[model samples]
Target: MSGDAAGGLESHDYDVVVIGAGGSGLRAAIAAHEAGARVAVVCKSLLGKAHTVMAEGGIAAAMGNRWKEDNWEVHFRDTMRGGKMLNHWRMAQLHAQEAPDRVLELETWGALFDRTEDGLISQRDFGGHKYARLAHVGDRTGLEMIRTLQQRTVALGIDVFMECTVTDLLKDTGAAEDRVAGAFAYWRESGRFVVFRAPSIVLATGGIGKSFKVTSNSWEYTGDGHALALRAGASLLNMEFVQFHPTGMVWPPSVKGLLVTESVRGDGGILKNADGKRFMFDYIPEFFKAETADSVEEADRWYDDKINNRRPPELLPRDEVARAINSEIKAGRGSPHGGIFLDIASRRSPEFIKRRLPSMYHQFKELADVDITAEPMEIGPTCHYVMGGVEVDPDTEQSGVTGLYAVGECSGGMHGSNRLGGNSLSDLLVFGRRAGEAAAAYAEGTARSRPTVAEADVAVAQERALAPFSGGEKASENPYTIQSELQQTMNDLVGIIRTAAELEESLVEIEAYQERARHLIVEGHRQYNPGWHLALDLANMLLVSECIAKAALARQESRGGHTRDDFPGPDPTWGAKNLVLSLDATGTGVNLKEQPLPVMPDELKEYFA
Candidate 1:
């Protein structure tokens, strides 16, 4: 924890530095420490309060605790199909094969998941899974997972720098090649600049949901990892694929984008429009027709007699359900609030509802004044996650840049265009460990070729971070105002449904925001100043938003999370190629190109046949 102060910047050295404290980052830190590497974790929040705690669903795994027939092969097939077969096959296969072990490992570390009648870990049903495969603890699974990981982290004596935000990643441009050197950051409490010098850096900084007005993500998710990777010479994959979760609170104004966990629907909840018709049945796509129930009787029977009938249409992949909700609202059948009704009270008993979804029961009662035991909840599609992120090697979780790695939501290609409901937690555990181990190995192997953090680079980062305070209060543009406008632009144009005209318009608006952001003015000083922090975050948000808009405009077809109204059907040609975005040589604008998807092995392809 020792550091030298030079040019007003505090510098600390470590073998591996993880730039997030969520599930993936903490797990990576633990693994790096276990591998005998000096590790440090930097996070924007307290130790146990990263945005991972907001995940209410359980970890997806094929432990077969609830259903004997469930296995890794089945989980693999489900994940591939859920992502519309556009997923990086190797990543999906590894995630499915490794998820069960990861979940059990969490239990060994004292995760306390709910149990079945026979005392094995309980598994619940979620959208796009073939069986009840989500290992959970009521609805607080994320909170429990964080608690377990954080406790293990402290016990292992892992160093955690809480309330720290990294603004840029420094690169070592040697005579032979360029490599990652360190990270430039600042403390949120005191607002003092700090630099972490590490040969290996893992970015687990999560998603880009905050760029949208209505999102389930916290303010910390302003696309920091995505932007950092791009600027540090890594490419982002499938940037057009932004996931809008089917259920987010749409009422009471204050909590409009708060998430309503999918665990409710998993435990017998149904979605209905104002006409009291279960609208999901009408919206089931041709892709899932073979497995989804067509009638209410069969749908209900499938819950009790899984072997005899198809699963309910309400349990379709998230992309399909979200689109259906959007269509329902566009029509005149929406609820009083601009959403559809999710009814669990009528299907399950009060005690059962509370036992299975305790968070939903309390969230509604406290935030919206609606009790799940009494009435249906009003929910709609809200910006939830970005399936797109820094492209990384599926085996090692290392990005294209040497000495840099990414995992969880910050790294792309695991979930393709749409992620299954419970897969995020398991993905974090599986790839988090892989990235940590790989980062440590990279650090150990690169001692001689280790990159150095130059004093000149540190000076430039400091100047760029302090640009917002240059012209004082009369700088014309306010950071908050610019951020609000950017959110509105993304939400209105590049949302669940898109068209060429709107997508083009959004790029124009984003360009305007990027220009305005350069002249942003913050009122307060550096110490504990939220406006100043947001001023810095706006740069990342603007860059990532442009990538999303550019990719959305380039891909002219409908598939999974990315849908275009002008080109309403999924094109086979477009489906086979992924749009890769990278910062051009000038480092100002992003360049877009296509890369063919990795061909799946013949044996694995037989699953679809």
Candidate 2:
């Protein structure tokens, strides 16, 4: 609501504009402000209530606080291998090299991490880590991370527009190659429109998980950034790699898909079938077999003696564990609630469980009426994260479009095909700072020739955003119904395990949903209307769903988060390539093209060799 009138529309100008208030967005804003740039952060939720607070595991970093052998090189190797070697080598390298420094930087900015016996920042075990490498604050690491970052942002005096939703990216038509000039947004409270005019825009808007029916994502994660980037002529990479987390609550209907943090498994939890057998050992892939324990005895011994024994199969990458759980459910070995059992009760004492994973313990006790200290929790795969997002530069996080940047869960290539648990927080810090610094530099360079927001473009965006309100009361199409159908379509056909037939059928259903969405009608006034807001968000979800489905079908190989039932194994040919999604010429459909993966230097390739 704070802006000056520009051509009769409310407009605010800044050097850099960040489109989220999560961990990445806050870090970016702080970085830009420190670099002497006037920055503005716009978010769809309150300051401390972003989906980032929902991250319960620790920040992955090679601090080596607990393990002497841990370092950046090992972290790099683990990331590349965990991602199935499809990662952009430079991004993975940079992330690993910088993560420790970023974590320590958070402490300097007043983050209070759990301490080791020697008084160093404590590091804990997580899936895909070669050592205990997660810097944590018990199980509420993300909550503490957000608290620290929010304080840093406030201390820097960066402007924040809370409860604001961006509907479109405004491009400057005057430039020979169109560049992002600003953004079109609306206040979630009053439904009043506002425009942010900036030379550089950083999209830290997270992922597309909410498009699926059962997901760990909050309602605000409707793929707004992905759709905005596509419409602004930026391409998304690896849209097929949608990560369904292995442990989402599945017992009670209401809390189904709520996340069960990886901390549970990291702190000695194990997965079991209905017959009370440890099942993850049977699902370890050939690639991971060399480093994974083949028997229960060694896996258990690993907890106390890390130097000699291989890690547990329960600590495999998310995609592997999720697929294993899905297979167990389908094979009739699942719990009564149609999921596998995640038990930490028998392995660890009640006091240890509460001290290590207080959040997970309470989440189950309050929501599902299950006690983690005594019984197993019924859990299954739920759409958690999308490794696909705006394709950005490895060093600066800038997209192909000038003056536009993306970071965190809204950017691709850093995680490649699968993200290791705890790595997400570190990715946000590393890339968020790079993007903010780069955006500030770009904004300064363009000060003399800043792109102008065309009044005409703003008018078009406003019309599209307000269209749902004008539909008659008797209109047959309902926004909520269309959204529900779309979610079910994605969950049923394009979920954890997919087939060519189901993928094709999903595309057809998506098209029908699109038609229904076009005629969407909401029965409410513009002010504080949830239905109208959903109507606007539906467009983003539908567009992103098409990208996911099309990319999944075209990939034609099983790898990482994307598993094709017909093509059950990873194909060498597809492993060396990436699929990029862009808007078609008409800007009404998506087009996909195969691009060669970035070649790793011989020095770095030695890790895989």
TM-score of each: 0.98, 0.98
* Residue range 297-378, candidate 1, lDDT tens digits: 8898887878553789889999999999999999989999899999999999999998889999999999999999989999
lDDT of each: 0.92, 0.92
Each prediction's number of clashing residue pairs: 0, 0
Candidate 1 — which residues are off by over 4 angstroms?
Answer: 1-7, 307-309, 472-474
Candidate 2, overall lDDT? 0.92
Q: For model 1, what is the error of residue 542's alpha carbon versus the real structure, in angstroms, after optimal superposition?
A: 0.3
lDDT of 2 at 573: 100
RMSD of 1: 2.4
| lDDT per residue (tens digit) for residues 231-335 in model 2 | 999999999999999999997999899999998999899999999999998999998898999999989888888736489999999999999999999999999
TM-score of candidate 1 versus the correct structure, residues matched by position:
0.98
Report the C-alpha displacement of residue 142, candidate 2, in angstroms: 0.7
Candidate 2: worst-modelled 10 consecutive residues by lDDT: 1-10
